[model samples]
Target: MMKSLLNAANFQLLWFACILGGDNWAVAAIVLYLIVHHYFFVESVSEWWVILLFVVLGVFIDGALIFDGWLVMPPSIWTFPIPPPWLLGLWAGVGSLFFHCLSWGLTRPWLLSIGAAVFAPLSYFLGADLAEVSLGRSSIATWALMAFIWFWLMQVGVFTTRLTIRRNGRTHHV
Candidate 1:
């Protein structure tokens, strides 16, 4: 049982989950800042609530994309034959990590949005390629496109989040 638990695929899945959760945690830092600083104040919404919502949304999006064939995992990783749950977990983990990383930024919303749009895709592709090599999958150009799509999605998420905060009459902190 221990051997099976320590299998390579399982380890990969674990790492992926960590990344997903970590990114989301990072994002939560930003939300916390907004709440404490009163930059994006919403009467009905609390920081924890927004964080939870973002976590759920990120998980759902990741799972849906993987299940729909928009993204492919490494071939050697058969531990997650059922893609949805694995992806959902991974998304949550990675998003948390990202949020943590960007928590202390002083940039404006538009700048942050643009930066995320550009970097997210590049980072996704890098991660994908690393996964592919580790999984021994054939190289494909579609992965590049997948990275671009990821970037676009990240941009949309940031844009929508910012807009929502602004609509609630919150001031931009940076």
Candidate 2:
């Protein structure tokens, strides 16, 4: 229980640093640290690969939102044609949490979906407030869409985690 709480705390801190830091080299370092931390301390290499797949999926989905004007990011140091690296790093943190801090949700898809629907949008709103990201002028609609997206995404994560764990000859409880 203590380990779970500490992992969650680390995830939140790293995520905040990435999002609030904007597009900086430190964001890259933070992300690299997150990957290393996950690879060495959190889970096995196979689990890390699964986590990374979700991270990439998140990047593409969020990147689409940024491209479609549903979300906006301010100019940053590592500016590209998509959402900033910090946002991707934020996703990486959240993705990593799926297998560690929030592993209980792996056995409860409905609860995971509901939790994600609420917390995902709330986190995005918090990030918007903390950083230069926003959910556009129609914030409520955007928040609703975000909740909807996360509802399914959480289910997908649950299923993927189960499949990966089972394939690796591990108990699917976590």
Candidate 3:
């Protein structure tokens, strides 16, 4: 319980850093947090795979949104195939939470599903406002689409975690 609290705190700090500090700060925070997390909380290299999976999925999802103009990022050549650098860092943090702070959601996938539908979109909604990223024209419509996408993303998350854990022959960390 105490570990979870700390990890959650770390995640929240990462969120603020990524949203407010942009790409450079996001990279620094992600590196610091992952180093600490790996040294103390991680048991195996399999965890790296989790972060990788999230990165790929996150890029695809957010890239599509950006390409379609649902989410407008700062102009960059990397805008189509990859999302903003800070957002990539943010997704890595979220993936880390699955094994540390929010591992309980593995057993009860519904919690994460519900959270995806409810809180996940709100994060983007709020982050866009703070970071000056645009949510296209209609924030409400974009938010609704985000909600739907996140809910399904959780399905992939749950499946991936289960498959990875089962193959590795261990329960998740934390």
Candidate 4:
């Protein structure tokens, strides 16, 4: 229990560091940590795969947002319209949370939606404050759209885990 809690905290801290600071090296370190930690501690490779899936999905989503001009990243760092390294790192940390910190929300869609509605926009708003990213058109409208996007992402995570369980032919907590 303690270890899980600590891992969860670590994930959040890594996300904050990457997003708020735009630290690429921090993201690299986090990737290393996830690799080593998963090798020894995570129960199965499937969980790691799920994490990868989350990363890919997250990156794609961010790419779409950037492409549509809903979020504006630094032009210098906007290589290929995908989210920058720091945001990709944030996705990795968020991927981990689907199994650990925020796992409880998987079974509670309404709660997850409510949480996402509040916290997702808050994170972006915080990011804006840090000058990492900016709302593309209107701040209020962008935030509302971001809330909906995150809510969908959370729902997809739960659904994906369920699909993984069925395909694996075993019941397991993701």
Model 3: per-residue lDDT, tens digit, 49-151? 8878888888888888888989888654343467877898888887777777778888888878888889998899899989888888586787789889888
lDDT of 4 by residue, 105-144 (tens): 7679679878888898888788766755767878779878
Per-model TM against the reference: 0.44, 0.90, 0.91, 0.84
Provide the clashing-pair count of each candidate structure: 23, 0, 0, 0
Task: Give the runs in model 3 whose Cα sits over 4 Å from its true position.
Answer: 75-81
Provide the lDDT at 150 for model 4.
87
Write the residue-wise lDDT of candidate 1 on 40-76 in tens digits: 2223343334445555776565546666666665543
**Taking the tens digit of each residue's C-alpha lDDT, what string does model 2 give over 43-152?**
55667776687778877898899888888777666557656777777676776776676789987889989999998898888888888776775878988999999999
lDDT of each: 0.45, 0.76, 0.81, 0.72
The collision pairs in model 3 are none
Select the stronger candidate by TM-score from 3 and 4: 3
Point to the candidate with the largest TM-score: 3
TM-score of 3: 0.91
- lDDT order, best first, reads 3, 2, 4, 1
| Model 1 TM-score, 2 decimals | 0.44
Clashes of 3: 0
lDDT (C-alpha) at residue 145 in model 3: 92
